[model samples]
Target chain A: MQIYLPIAEMSVSVLLILGMGMAVGFVSGLFGIGGGFLMTPLLIFLGIPPAVAVATQSAQIVASSTTSALAAWRRRALDVKLAGVLLIGGLMGTALGVWFFAAARRAGQLELVIVISYVTLFSVIGGLMLKESIKEFWSTRKGAVRPPRRGGQHPAYMRLPLRVRFYRSKIYVSALPVLGLSLSIGFAGAVLGIGGGFILVPALLYLFRVPTAVVVGTSQFQILWTTLAALVLHAVANQAVDAVLALLLIIGGVFGAQFGARAGRNLRADLFRLLLALLILAVGVRFAVELVVRPTEPFSLVVSEMRE
Target chain B: MRFGLALLLCLLAAGPAGAETLVASLSTSQVRITSNYTGSQIVVFGAIERDAQTVARAGPYQVVVTVRGPRQAVTVREKSRTGPVWINGPQQKFVQIPAYLGVFASAPIADIATPGQRGRLRIGLQASVNAPDITMDRGTEDDRFREALARLKIKELLFIEDERGTTFLTPSLFRTPVPLPVTAPPGDYEVDVTLFADGVLLARAGTSFEVIKTGFEQRLAEFSTEWAALYGLGTAAVALLFGWLATVIFRRD
Candidate 1:
């Protein structure tokens, strides 16, 4: 059950990697997120080089997101026009992210920046989700007035300069904040080497008041394309993609995604949000603890380049 | 690298080589890294051969075997806690140092050879790391950074030393095993077997082997670098294929 990864230059247990992939895939299907936020860190923890782990993970993300994204699309739950705008902003962010990533690396603070960003993103996003979901759960139990879902009840800040109508979400909101939201998401995604699905899903629901189900589909659609772009970039820049490893992950991931998507439909939206909020906070707390605890080994080695 | 070994062998043979000359062979000269390759061990079997001018010695002969993997540049970075978080501080780069180094001796290297002799011959782990070839990127060889590098490598199972790793089968014959960890990179590795008696170097012999990725692993690694874009597209296609298959099997809408 031991297999050697070609590009990563490491030997890993097949079953262990399969299990990790399946777990991420389940998250992908259930939440309509790429799950790269979890998968990348897990890969690095298993001793895969950071560069290789980041590059190779895109393939797994593509597989997981596509499985759920395509399903949502077939069910007519995805918003293509909205996702398209987000894609444009994401691409712009990717270019900026890569340049900044290189600069941070040159300063030898890339690891610090990545860890800090992870802690900050996870806590803020997870904290807000938990708070809102708890309130939503209680309000429903009391039979109180539900939060507004239809568009046009916009706050002053959301009423930006240019207005565009999204027919699917029934929103006549400005495109500026939407574009800006995606731009920042993309930048964060590139810096963290993740798909940004977790953040995207929540942002769509809170900011645009996108329907619960549609938010899943749209975020997944966006994740699929961004991960594909990332895969190609890593390939061209570092040639770090390990095809064999990715294939193993995909085999397990696709199976897990099927079951997870089915389970997602049966679960209530409030309960789903509660679980996701817990998961996100758990990951955040884990990283935070790592930062505080004294490391067993404080020195690490980085090879300059591979030699033939 | 092979030429360097050959030159070292010639110089050793031409040196004050007494009657006894070391002869050595390897269990495997080429390790093909297949899909199932985790790690492996290679044995060094050698004998002492003497010519007509052979003479009996007052003390028993001791053997020391050193196996070194290919040289590579590695940057060792140090991290110190800043408030609640530990952040990387100053770093040093080890230029063209052996990626893997293992020393196996019949007795403790220090017990068998004097510090001066060990340093001159690069016979032990300390001498190997502190050899004249080792150079840092910045500042002096502040013992702290170099020690940390050695310590980390040892923890990773890349740098090793076993005082009793070598054993003598008979008076003039011996054998030792060199272990290659899963992390061992594919490269050319050199094996040096030195004969010592009463803290004096007698004879030395050297051999080499290669660790290479063969069959599927080899081609995939090459394809990724040579046809980078195509490789990426191919992996993406496979993912898409799997994803589509999932949808078909679990169709529910």
Candidate 2:
């Protein structure tokens, strides 16, 4: 059935929107990430206005990440203290990001900025994940069980003031890097309409050497809060969130996440990492291609602020 | 579109003294956009009135009806290759242009009136979009931008022209359906009807209709802007509730 979206000022097929949410949610569940990066582009490809697409998907991310975060909490995989620290900066960054988003829209550069950031972010994070996962996959195939290493010397950059021991991740690092990392990622996430979990998971894994299992849970917890903040900010600042669209997507997402989580449990660890890494790279390449390629219709439209 | 309202006939104009005058009205004064509103069509119905001393001297009369939605500010941007990426290039900002425009005619527009005459009356699609204040840099490049804007609007069905859209039921009565596309902005829509005979402008009549959201849709739009903080929280709450419910039903841990 076709339903009108009030904020978007468009009519879209309910089934089509539901299907998009289901597919994106399945990825979110399987990877334990919010999958906002995937869903935002898909929404725009389906012809929802970019402002509405970005704002509405922020709300959808809250729904998907909440499921992943709760599941991780139940499994005792999530670190609540770490999430609390991350959120302190994440919320601050999200507020700044929303203001930047409004400024970019007024300048008619929002889409260009979004595409460029997507290509740059995914290429870096996806490349890193692919390299690490490939190394682990081949080592395991050679029947070499990974050996436990002695506690390593702290990375030089991490030795800063205000040290804290994150009991869950079993790491002692300066809180500055943690706050800075999340704050930067939060700003990037809010602008790009993503949960930033794809970047967060690998950053935790590589920089702080967070345990892989804990990384997914902790990142999901962080995504849940940041995206909730983004949703609220976009709604209040831009007034562009489509309530109808968000509701439809959430309904489908809840069902898809259940099936994906079940499927994820059966996958081998090394193989799961390899698959997710490749998927992230593919989406990054898609955005890169869109940038350089000559568009079929080069003209676009925008409604400026109301003229009194 | 309905006609035969002889009692409501008011003389709008006459080509000469005491000649035939045009009288017109619309099917509805307001179009309510409900949840299921895909699009709508408004019928413009009219009649020809003549006094006791008047005479029908010329060929068959022609009717041209134009419906223009509320004036809106818009910017049209064109993308061009810049380095390895394509970015918005030259842009044109229109301070006031019809968000929705549709034109209906009893005959082919070209046959009804000459291009110059049509342009003067601002009767056709080309004339409707042309406003001197809209284009500041009047060059071929700016022309391309304006044409591109029209093309884009036409592609979206926001600009429409249907020759033979209006039909005459009798010698004095006529009606036409002016389609308002799904994307039509909600506001006042001006409907102008013109009469032509032998390529000469004869009579003119103007009416208007309003496009408005129904109570439910109106409230939703207003609440999003007025109570934005609450609206934002409510959407988030719904998401959180759904998330919690999913875990209850599907949790494996």
Best-performing candidate as measured by lDDT: 1
**How far off is each candidate at the interface, as Cα RMSD in Å?**
1.4, 1.8
Each prediction's RMSD to truth:
2.6, 4.5
TM-score of chain A of each: 0.93, 0.88
Q: Give lDDT: candidate 1, residue A244.
A: 88
What TM-score number comes out for model 2?
A: 0.90
Give the alpha carbon lDDT tens digit for every residue of A62-148 in model 1. Answer: 887888888988988888999999999988887888889999999978989998999999988999999999988899989998765
Task: Say which candidate scores most in TM-score.
Answer: 1
lDDT of 1 by residue, B96-212 (tens): 778889999999998888887677678889998776567655477556778887898898899999999999999899999999998889999999998987777788789999999
Candidate 2 predicts chain B with a TM-score of 0.88
Categorize the docking of model 1. Answer: medium
Worst 10-residue lDDT window for candidate 1 chain A reads: A148-157
Candidate 2: count of backbone clashes, pairs at least 3 residues apart or interchain = 0
